[model samples]
Target: MNTYFITGIGTDVGKTVVAAIVTEAMQADYWKPVQAGELQHTDTHSVEELISNSKSVMHEHSYALRTPMSPHAAAAIDGVHIDLEMIEEPETENHLVIEGAGGLLVPLNEQETILDLIKNNYKVIVVSRHYLGSINHTLLTLSELRSRGLEVSGIIFNGKAHPTTEHIIKKMGHVEEIGRIDEEAVIDKQVIKKYAEMFKPRLEAL
Candidate 1:
């Protein structure tokens, strides 16, 4: 059972969407360890709704905060501390899809960042969405992962295809282009299933 840790260059880069695709593709269990806000419509709930696979199980978050902010701030507001050691991964026999918040450097606590939550065994998938200055963000993300000696499986581009941006990212980062999620009008279960099928081959290869 492979564990895919889905991260992004920055916030709103579609990590949850890509995580859904990968989870559906692999029929994997889903987990979001530290959700900062939106307790009503959490990432775990969103992925559960998006995926059509019966094999995928939605795991409870390790830390569910009330405020919509970084985990550290949210935890503080709630009068608690996020201990990385206490943030345990759910025990799952199936392939697990772990969606991260914001970006790699986002603080989970005063001492630890989001990067600290990713275990060495998990295959990292950096979700890169094209925007101005995205190239630098993408490269820096990959560089940090490399420097930490984390195993980066590849990148999943999320948004309209930008050949030049994609070209540069692939060439410079030297990471596999696993697959991409094109701009979708409505990302329903059917749409998620479509992208699941499209990404299955490459995901299986990983």
Candidate 2:
């Protein structure tokens, strides 16, 4: 079975959109360890609904904190502790995609960060935007992953407005230029597939 952990440089960077696309492509099961700020039309629900394959199972946090803050702060506001034990692992499946709450350093509890919850057995995918300072944030994130001895698949640049010269400068490992998302608010399946194919090698390498 193949397992993947999806994280981003920051919030609203299309991690969930890319996660949904991968689930749809591989017909894999999906799990969101912690979900904060869930509204009527949420990314988690949208992903669960869009992926039509009956084989995929979507699992979310038992306590859906209402605040649009970090998981630790949100849980504290609700008088609850963010417990990793509460996060259930998916049943034996061919592929499992675990989506992080926010970025890599987002606190899950007082001591544990999102990276702590991630299983080393899974390949990590960092999702970031093509805006300014992205290169720095992406590199920092990659460094952290390397420090943790985690395997990074590659990066997915979401919501790219215009091409930048950093694309050439940031070429490190087997990097792929995943297509951009024009509309930041909506999730486009085609864009997901375009990027998903770029992630194919890393996914297959696992």
Candidate 3:
């Protein structure tokens, strides 16, 4: 079974949307691992709403903190300690999609970051949104993953494309452009399904 770790350059980069699309595309089991905020409308809930496939299973989060902050900070505010040992990956026969919080270096605890949860065999998928200095952020994100000897499957560009910025990122980052999620006013299941169909081929090719 293939495991895909969905991460982003930073927060609000559409990691959850891309994760839902990938899960719908592959009909894979979905796991968020760690959720910091939006407990009433968590990433798991969002993905569950977007998914149309009946085969996909939504695995519970290892840690669901209440405060809308970094996992470590959120845990602290909640009077809880984030422990890496306690965050065990769920076993599944189908493909698994794991979503990370914030970015690669987002701390889960004093000793470990979100990157620690990624195992050697997991394929990393990065979600990048174009903005001022995004090229730098995107490059740095890819560089960090590669430096840690992680296998980055490719990148999913979110929102409108910036030709020059994307050009430089693709050329320098040395990562395939899995697909882009165009700016959508309303991203319903139909919209997600549309992108899922569009991204299915490339994701399967991975």
Candidate 4:
């Protein structure tokens, strides 16, 4: 089965939203190895709801940490360990879309980052916002993936704050802005559908 690991340049950059859109487009199962900052109103379940028929499986430390902090620090405060092996391979027939807890280099353990857990198993998709400094973050993320010999399917520009962000990304070469979400609120089915449709050709090319 084809597998993809969805990561972002930083937190709150819409990784989950991008993952949901991709899952809808590809009809893939979704997995979140470690989820933090689950409030009473917003959680991973909400993300799963957006992707039609996409099965979601969480790790043992899924709900253990509640703070909106980095996984390593959140786990540390909760006295729990974020074990990479705890994230089991799912049994679904669809492709697996694993969403990382935070950014590329966020620590899963003291010595290991989330990138380490996902590098060899899945093609990476770096999600970035279209705000200031996005170019630097996206380039750095792309460089890191290349340095590790990891295949990057493409970059998704979430929350396009500028008019020329997509053009800039495409000009860089080897990276396509597969999708963009312009809404300033929680993404809904229509939004997901819009992006899924926009991403179809790009996804097929991948």
Model 2 C-alpha lDDT per residue in residues 143-203, reported as the tens digit of each score? 7888898877666666645455346525753355433445545546655555556655555
lDDT of 1: 0.93
Give per-residue CA lDDT, model 1, range 23-142, as digits (tens).
Answer: 999999999999988999998888989998788899998999999999899999999999988888999889999999999999988999999988899889999999999999999999
Better of 2 and 3 by TM-score: 3
Q: How accurate is candidate 3 locally (lDDT)?
A: 0.94
- Local accuracy of candidate 4 as per-residue lDDT tens digits, 35-140: 7677553435666667654354432324347777888898888888887677566667777777887778988779888788675767678888876788788887
Candidate 4 wrong stretches, greater than 4 Å: 39-43, 53-63, 161-163, 184-186
Model 3 residue runs over 4 Å out of place are none
lDDT of each: 0.93, 0.73, 0.94, 0.74
In Å, residue 199's CA in model 4 sits off its true spot by 1.2
Residue 188 lDDT in model 1? 93
Error of 4 at 148 (Å): 0.9
The TM-score between candidate 2 and the true structure equals: 0.84
Model 1 worst lDDT run, 10 consecutive residues: 84-93
Candidate 3 worst ten-residue window by lDDT: 160-169
lDDT of 3 by residue, 1-206 (tens): 78999999999999999999999999999999889989999999999999899999999999999999999999999999998889999999999999999999999989899989988899899999988889999999999998899888999999997888888899999999999999999989999999999999999988
Residue 173's lDDT within candidate 2 is 37
Taking every candidate in turn, the Cα RMSD to the unseen true structure, in Å, is: 0.7, 2.9, 0.7, 2.6
